[model samples]
Target: MEMENMIGLTDLLAAAIRAWKQICVTMLVFALLLGGYQGYRQYKLATDPENSPEKIEERYQAALEDYEKRGEELQKKLEGQEESLASKEEYREESLLIKIDPYNKYITNIVFSFSNIDESAQLFRYPNTAADYLPKKIRSQYLELWKSMDVPRDLADGRYADLEWKYLNELISIPALEGELLSIRTMGASAKDAEDLAGAIFAYFDGHRDAIGRSSAAHELSILNQSTKYVIDEELKTKQESLDKEIEDLKTGIEDTKQSIEDLTEPEREDGYSVTAIVKSVAKYVALGAAGGLFLACFLVCCWWIFADRAANSFQLERSVGAPFLGAMKPSCPPAERLAAAVMGERRWRDPEQASAYIREQAEAGFPKEGKVLLLSTLPEGKAGAGMAGLASALEGYAVTSVLDALHDPKAVKAIQDCAAAVFVEMAGQSRLTDIRDLAAQVEGAKRPVLGVIAI
Candidate 1:
């Protein structure tokens, strides 16, 4: 029973195997179509400048050169000043102060007025008070009093005398003090004495002259420095503008060149030939289109094979156990065999008993009873043999018995041959079995009269 079931299954799988070529060819066709589509897409993308590595590299180089040139020009324009003003630490400190109170009037006013002021001068006159001349401990009290204006330092005795003579001289030299000093000199002081006093005052003022000169010189130098920066900045701006224009022109030219290349060497259409005849001529020898066609054809053949395989498997399962087999067919083979079978009413027999009776009648009509011992056989694992055996057993006056346990016992074939009219049933329809024609010859050539044979 297990053997019969396995034989049925094997017959089914063998039919499917016979159709494997068609299935493989179909799959190959689909694979080729997919591969062709991908190849065409790649070709189109490559023809465009944006996707071409060489073109991309060329554009990148041009951009890099432009950037480098701009950097060099900027460096030359702001040579010395860049080092001083471009320090990160200076910018960070300035940014911190700005963040504290962006609209604080005192800070805004001071920074705006004195951003260019000498650092030393700013430190010395930050408070701008007389307390700056006093000792630190005493200066604090003086500063407190000054803020309150409780005791005016100008009205106090010895305040005028204690004033630094250099500071006092600076006050005296003011244009507003000229007339008052002249009146004081005329009021009873001698010319010589007045002159000496004025001279002493001038000397006192001269002692503090270093601070004024340094402040004035620094301011003038800052102005000169800014004027120079303005001139260089303008020159650099003009150069940058010129370079920008040139770069634009070059980019336009590059784009035009790329467009021309695309127009001249565009990708081909689905027919596997380029639009440009010149390109096609050069590339025709590569046989790219032929290769693609071959792949598509094979794929289609594989699909047909798979479809046929499924049909064959279904046929095996649905077929009745007593049905007679038509001859095996292949798409590539000649149709003569099928035509012959059809004309003889042997294409397929639905009733195995009718087929067996027909065979027996034909044999008895032609040959003697001594020649009726027909040894019918099939390929190993073939259902055709079992069907034949069943038909043979149903024959009149013939005691038919099937012995199929030979798979385990090699000598079983000899043991079963003792019967007067024996039909040795060999399996069939498996891919690895011996050739049908070869097995037929071997069985029929035996001394027994082999009447008829069938393949699953």
Candidate 2:
């Protein structure tokens, strides 16, 4: 068998050399694609510096420094104006309250004093003049007595007037005297002038004490109004401008960095090959070429192997099966008749009684007695016509004739004409038997009686 012929290294090498065109094309395409892809990747890395590790680290460091610098500047600005900022904010709130309810008389004189009471409820009322007129101990006792009383409006006028005079005289005197002194000082008055001024102030207070208190409150409100507007507005504007400038500077820095990165990037090519386009093109050609080369190589090798094996076996069969072994007149007998005769005859020749019995049975059945030729043949197991001739020759008193004209030498047909009976063997299977049958029919139509078939 062709399979028994071992393939050597030399044969494999020869086959590869024979297929070198396809292999070289495939390998060259692959190598070029790989090298081109690597080169393009390197080009991309070289061009896009923003994508580079060194540039990225540098940008990160720059951003960190800028952030720290901005933070420090903001901290310094905040530290420099901390007290002023708080004062301006407080003044703005006080000014707004005074503007909203200026004539509500208790507003300005309501001083908040710290005590052991809960700080959340510290907004308690006190006599407006208590800080000025009475001695500290006496004022404490008076406030305690006032708190204990429950004076209602329907009380007798005399009784109410008595309490009111006591409270007013004790609390209002010192504050009114302080105001008179301030007026006297402002007028640059001598003793005579002070005394005269004191009389007039006292007379004015005596006539309209509540009106004087209201006027004093209005004066304090005017002072707060004059100062708060300029200070609060200017401070807020300055801080806001500083913050806006800082934000604008940070944005400019970011934009500048982004522009630098864009400048460092490679510009798009108009006509030159792009890395992505080159890689895709190379891959496409490589895949197409490799596939075509592999398929062609496989197909050619398979065809050569099949044809070579078939030719070799046909040659061997033609050489082994000899000619003119069957009887001459009837050159076409089916090979099975010959093989049955061979097996039966071999069995009978080994035992004469069986052979005689078989022959006697055929004779009794009125089989043809004109020729003693027993065509012995069989379907070939491996070679095309070898088994037919081998089996026929193995039978006693049988001349074997094997023909190989279908796919081998056709000269055996003339030798088959001289045989008394011809046996035809068809190899392979049913599909292959058509040609064998055609040949058999031609031979059997001649004067010779053809025998039965043998199949394997």
Candidate 3:
């Protein structure tokens, strides 16, 4: 099946090569028509003032400069806001007051410290394995924070979880105390949430103090007994209200500055391709048209060549008609010489010197060796008449009967009956296969042996 398909494709390619000129002309004409339509569209766009390339580029450049200027102003304003928030008298006073507030402590920075945590670690193992050995519930709660932040749950290396652990480590520090201690701290958006999260973390350690390892139990108990660390100051809580109000006002000012920047920088987009871009795109297509036109022309020409009916060579002619190729005449042979050869009944023979000799040799091979012989030509009118005359002249030794119109003549069989043998002459590529077949059938019906085909 594959071989057959390949052969068919090969034939199609051959046909296309034969008709390449016609195919190329046709393709170029179609490409020009298509290019004209596209050019028309480009003309309309180029003429439109609002959408033209120059206008769009000018507007874009203006917008870009404005954005850059506003961006610098926005950065300065934000820096000023940050400085105000850090340096204001109220801000300092509030931070100090927050240090002592019972409720403020819950939402403020909490610190956890681990002493002798890495004392027993191996060189190849993580220095802080205590974080990994946490109770299942505590570990799950810690992992939940990362999951809420959209970290993938199936990460085997737990890369994001490790990052979160690093963040927890940053919130902790160990003092060079004389004993082992584990401190855990947590903070949230409000006093209540922070208090709850911190308390939960602290409770996990408090409840698991005995599990800290027997070697550190005594030190752990000492750290847990520091109850005065939770004491609160009532005066700072009272002052926290005013400080909160001042902070809120500063935040509002910063937000207003941000909004102004956003308003200045918001993008102003223009629809559709820019005029320059459109022109470039059209040029690209025109180039593609030239390339595609060439390719299509070649392909179509190959198809025409493959499917062409005319015999391309003597070998092809012999194979197509299932005949022995006796001889052939060159297409470059002059028309006058061809006509002269036809007039002397010698069109079937290639060499002029051999014509008379071939005639004398074949004269006695068929019936009525000494009588009239029929010379027939498959070509039309002038060509056939010239050939018949030539053959009659060639067979001067015998009484030769010429029949140029024998192919369609009703009495052609009767004319043939009067002759001993018949000759069929034809041009190789010019004659139709069907016409040749019809002529052969006619000669067979007359019961005359076809001497042979003459390829001219």
Candidate 4:
């Protein structure tokens, strides 16, 4: 078995473009053949007595049932996920009262003395409207005021920014107002968090005490005591964390199911088949045939290009020498061009003047003075020399210093060391990729640039 050779993407791409019209033609031919075959088949199927309207209607009913069944399943799954999430959230809120730590580990309490009417004086007296009524009303008002307190809310946002309002509010424990003595407890992530929050609450009552006394029949406001307490129940934090993770996972599942529902969307419902339904069916099959043909044609073109021995295009020339491909210049044959259009498409056309000018400009630019641009070929030394001479004699201004078989001529290696750059002259259907590669390696080894290729 022979060793395999490496093929470049440049080779495959150029080959495809060079034969685009041929690929298109192949697809057209296959499309016509397959479409005609499908048309005949569809015509037979249309006339078949087996496919009565009743059968087609039955097919529609079955498809509709399947669609509806699938939709119902998705809706049920979505509802189930929603219900589960809501139930878990409700449980989570209920547990939040115990879940949010007040002082993180330690809690603080501050006490205040506020004056209110002594109800002991009315122990023996019947309920009186004057003293009894006003004091009772004042007590109720004070409770409401504490319920709507904003000190804790402000502290939650500022000093204890990590704690949510609900959490911070939960962390604090307040007693019902009854007499002169009032105590408020606060807790947080650190002892400082609790102390700061307690201070803020105390400051609110102190600053607003006179107003509170006037509004609620209270006398004095003072901090009587300050104490710290420890909180127990390590499991509350763990329980809350577990609940949060579960809720998040459920949400992700719900989103995935939504995507699944979208992907498995209900199929379209078809109406009854018509008298000309056979014609429509035939056309649809023909379109499918054309699409199939295009796919196969591309597949064949790719395969042919991969295994071909010759580096036929300018792109491959560029890849071989790792240099800029100036362009390919070859004399056009009318018969060959015509045959190519009928078969593949002739190699992509490039104007000869543009091709030659590109070579000259690049060759001149590579070396401004006293530098030869070596024109190398795969042919024998005599043949290569004669070919270049004939080109110079025929073309008005096209010139070559010399032509040498870079792989065979000993002088070619020396020239590569001497010349500024080189260009390969590849004869159509003759220059092997192996020969070009060998010559390219020699040039590259000598550190000389290969400008590009010229195809004769």
- Per-candidate TM-scores read 0.27, 0.21, 0.38, 0.40
**What TM-score should be assigned to candidate 1?**
0.27
Report every candidate's CA lDDT: 0.36, 0.38, 0.52, 0.63
State which candidate has the highest lDDT. Answer: 4
* Predicted candidate 2 versus true structure: per-residue lDDT over 166-243, tens digit per residue: 322221222212221211111111233223323333333234423433322211101111010111234434554564
For residues 300-342, what per-residue lDDT tens digits would candidate 3 score against the true structure? 5555444444433334444444444444333335554445334
What lDDT tens digits, residue by residue, belong to model 1 across residues 16-35?
34445554565556555655
* Candidate 4 lDDT tens digits, 1-456: 122245545445545555667767876777778778866776676676656677777777788898889888988999999999998887676533554563256678887664544455444655554644545554455556677766445443364544455656666776755553567787655677677777777676566656655654555555678987667646657766788899999899899889878888555645434547656766777677777776777667768766556654444445555666544455554553434333332243367567556556655565335567677787665445544654343333433455556676677777778877777776533466778878888878888777676655
Ranking by lDDT: 4, 3, 2, 1
Better of 1 and 2 by lDDT: 2
Winning model by TM-score: 4
Ranking by TM-score: 4, 3, 1, 2
- Please estimate how well model 3 matches the true structure, expressed as its whole-model Cα lDDT: 0.52
Total residue pair clashes for candidate 1: 23
What's the true lDDT of residue 353 in model 1?
52
